[model samples]
Target: MKEFTFTITDPQGIHARPAGLLVKEAKKYAATLTILKGTKKGDLKKIFTVMGLGVKQGETVTVQAQGADEDAAAAAMEAFLKENF
Candidate 1:
């Protein structure tokens, strides 16, 4: 498994548009992706689960990628977080 931590910079946090985009991005990978916020975890492929976390600005979240393409998925996820959040 591969993982990276990210702090949300967006004022609105992981709102609808980005959440949708995030789910879309997650679906591109063969690896399984999970987003962790404190003790809460949400499947990256699931929009409702992600939004259910209520990730807010200034909060740090960990993203884990596990499976065949975890390495690539982790790198891409990190880049995506940096660019978007």
Candidate 2:
């Protein structure tokens, strides 16, 4: 498993578009991807699950990936957050 924490820097936070993008990216990997906000964690491949977390700007969330391509999943997610959020 691979994991890293990142702050939501986008002013709008993890809204529909970003969450959709996240789900899309997550789908590209064979690993299971999840996002943790506080004590709540949800599957990254599902948009509804991610949106249900109600993550807001400035919140620190943990991105976790577990499976054969965990490292790649983590790196891709980290890059997305850096470039998009």
| C-alpha TM-score for every candidate | 0.97, 0.96
| Cα RMSD to the true fold for all candidates | 0.6, 0.7
For candidate 1, which ten residues in a row score worst on lDDT? 76-85
Positional deviation of 82 in candidate 1, in angstroms?
0.7
In model 1, the Cα lDDT at residue 24 comes to 94
Choose the strongest candidate by TM-score.
1
Per-residue alpha-carbon lDDT of model 2 for 1-85, expressed as tens digits? 8999999988898999988988998899999999999999989999999999988889999999999999999999999889988
Candidate 2 wrongly placed segments (more than 4 Å): none
lDDT values, one for every candidate: 0.94, 0.92
Q: Over 4 Å off in model 1, which ranges?
A: none
Q: Candidate 2, after superposition: displacement of residue 46 in Å?
A: 0.3
